[model samples]
Target: MTRPTPAPKPSAPTGTSAAHVPLRWVGPLRISGNVAVTETEVPLATYESPLWPSVNRGAQISRTVDAGIRTTLVDERMTRSVLVEADTAETAYAAARAVHDRLDELRAITRATSRFAELLAVRHEITGPLLFLRFEFSTGDASGHNMATLAADALLGHLLAQVPGIRYGSISANYCTDKKATAINGILGRGKNVTAEILIPEAVVAARLHTTAARIARLNVHKNLVGTLLAGGIRSANAHYANMLLAFYLATGQDAANIVEGSQGITLAEDRDGDLYFSCTLPNLIVGTVGNGKGLDFVQENLTALGCREDRPVGDNARRLAVLAAATVLCGELSLLAAQTNPGELMKAHTRLERLTGARDAR
Candidate 1:
């Protein structure tokens, strides 16, 4: 009998062992939009095995239609807020006015920090003697977290020199609202604002999803809209947007923490005749094509596979990536909502898939 080999020791830090999560490519999802027009399989890395089939179901439905999932780029901007202190509110107000007036100079300063960072807007709020300046920028390709922060640092120095009586308080004022569930990101927008929508025929819905258009639409109103409101969810009305977002973010090497605000979105469903019109509007879908995590071997391969690594204009690749992310969100959201429409279907699928995964692990 052959002797069993001992488990290899981890070369990484003790706590940072190479723990693996199961990753699978799901769906040659047909997506049509201003940014991307392709049938692509998405890579999702997650322990939740049910998501793969759930999203695959939605993807199958997409292919039945001519246009498939339609993703639209609503808006795009990355923001960073810097804090400064003045002697009085009057001085703070003066500094804010000066900053607003010298927009050209500030744009130059922001550009000097990074070739990709371009100043889009500058918003300021003054309370007592404190000034919070939120600087929004268009960062090309990269997600623009570090880029925005670096630009904000340089802009802070410039503001201190040009605007008198305001000294540095902090680099981030929480007004940018990065990685946290806040209404500001939803209202003013922080990252990629993309909406993914699909119109499923009544026959397809009943055949694939085992539900009717009216049932799904009514469920959306009662469960997603009203339930979220009753729960006091801030700027969010959706079913399991974070589930798909996290899986996609992990596979594509995005800042996974961004799912906090990335998950804040609305699910709109309508009973159009007998067809089902499902849409997901994600205002804070933060993703990047070339960033910190893109250097990873798997991330590079995944981006290339997704066609996000194509040599496009500065922001085009990132926009394509954002649109893809939004479409994936819709796929998962639609499938889960459809499953919930039938009693015990959701739990049965979860229990069955998770058990299969566990059995495989045991093997």
Candidate 2:
């Protein structure tokens, strides 16, 4: 029998300040708590599936694009090796050129346009002995992990050929997984599943807010929801919303499967002023805006509604959705906290407002 190593203790948040506001709401819900959200998009082309050759390859390519987009984001900073997508091969090439022109750096490009249109984009940075490469590309549709890997591998091969002396190293490909693992490890005894911690100073204000302002340490609400579903349990909590969004992603040519691990890790805390903060960090979000199922009329319409353009990179849209999901989860956590602490307060307030409106309308 192997004994598990104890989880490392979590370090207190550095640079936390005392609240100056008498009745301030902090964390994800509070206006005082500073939260940062950023997103990126890449485009991909449809390609042949390895599993089935007879079926249209567009679906496979689309999936790859989604995975590639997720890979680029989820980290604190963007690196080289970006991805791009477009409707035609010409457009894909043009997009790559445009990105290169903007950055004014030499980059290697690879085309996977047999079944669809696509391009692989990457940027390089050197930090002393480490050569950091940030890549963004379009995966077309479905879960484009394979396509992204192919593109990145091809580009890296080309880069290696050009720069003979650059020693490339292997880093974690998925940002959400790596970050969530680190976060979870900090809270739980290395591998404890259900762990809890309090975010001091930030926890105070999070306690008072009606919105999703609580800071969470190691709760992946999405994963929990999926686990419940797999175990034949009813859907509850913000996990339901995550499921809906994931369905949309899958049906609309994004990577639906990643929803399982993508929805992991969250931050909830309170401040000195009884305010609450809540934030969700998903490091495994795989999404795309073009290729595969995107060609479907309804999917295209949804993309339009979401303000995604064919000329733009799909990763950009993925980032937007990720941020929206995080915000939504934050709000949901706040609702839970409010209801748990002050039952029926929101309902009574709603009834009071409805009565006041009715009286005014009668006049």
Candidate 3:
């Protein structure tokens, strides 16, 4: 009541102050994948205290298996969409055709923009006098947001100069569907599309997860598949991919907002002879080895620790990072789903862990 101390007179800004979040290294998880084959611990920065132990439990299970968490890189690309207005619908259609036919020329423009950004494909949508061109590129090492944008800018400039009867509408037209949840990103692919799989023995599932394989499989069907369908989820079917993705993204110096689309994934489970076959497929795992936000001291340390700072091929580091990120998701998703299979298990764990840490409103 004696006046709040005037909020300490509002300290002066020092350019930018760091927002320090709780960081922990979870898991010496064994991940054997197309991109990575190593047992590594991942750094996760999140406010959720329970996630550390939850992922750690899944990591423990991974150690018991021979193959461990097997990750596969399905596809990888970053897209940038540019909108242009034509004089008429026919002109827009013609311009779209011209762009598609001139892929080589566009590639040259993209190459001129950035050495790492290579033009992969150009797809277009025409609506009346509007033309939306989605340019896809393979951006090496970096997440490719800036690289794609720079290439798109150059391509757009060339199109305006050469293509007739079209003017710039906007650099982005949502057709690229960067962060927003959309069906196209899942179907066509964006970022690093990866799938992580693990086959747990019957005894391991019973002893570690404390649930039968049949129960976890049934839960995946009812909760992940059907439940997501009922919830009108655009292109995602998972219990809590966002939680792990957010933590991993923060720790690895990724564009955390990319988790919006990055979390759009599928969790598949099957009961095979009392064993469990669990997999998490993330189609939009947007991460990078070298890019913005990675220059920070802590980020550099984390990346180096994760073996992403190696002098491998141009795109290997980023792909390796993506694989690890997917494996991390599998660990967290598997643990959370196992917890949810039993009534009150999730809440009890949350309450106990949060209360132990003195977090407000433990429940």
Total clashing pairs in model 3: 0
lDDT at 40, model 1: 91
Candidate 1 residue-wise lDDT at 358: 92
Q: How close to the true structure is residue 60 of candidate 1, measured as C-alpha lDDT? A: 91
Better TM-score candidate (1, 3) = 1
lDDT: worst 10-residue window of model 3 = 9-18
Scored by TM-score, the top model is 1
Q: Which prediction has more favorable lDDT, 2 or 3?
A: 3
**How high is the lDDT of residue 167 in model 1?**
97
Better of 2 and 3 by TM-score: 3
User: Candidate 3 lDDT, tens digit per residue, 1-363?
Assistant: 576555554432322113567788988999997888899999888889899999999999999999899999999999999999988999999899888888898888889998799999998888989999999999999999999999999999999999888999999999998999999998888999999999999999999999989999999999999999999998899999999999999888898999899999999999999999999999998999898999877788889999999999899999999999999999999999999999999999999998886755354
Worst 10 residues of 2 by lDDT: 16-25
Residue 268, candidate 3: alpha-carbon lDDT: 95
* Model 3 residue 8 distance off true place after TM-score fit, in angstroms: 18
TM-score of decoy 3: 0.94
Model 2 agreement with the true structure over 177-268: per-residue lDDT tens digits: 32232332222211111111223233333333332333222233333444544765421223333433343344345555544544444333
Lowest-sum lDDT 10-residue window in model 1: 10-19
What C-alpha lDDT values do all the predictions have? 0.91, 0.36, 0.91
How high is the lDDT of residue 198 in model 2?
Answer: 22
lDDT of 1: 0.91
Candidate 3: RMSD over Cα atoms? Answer: 4.8
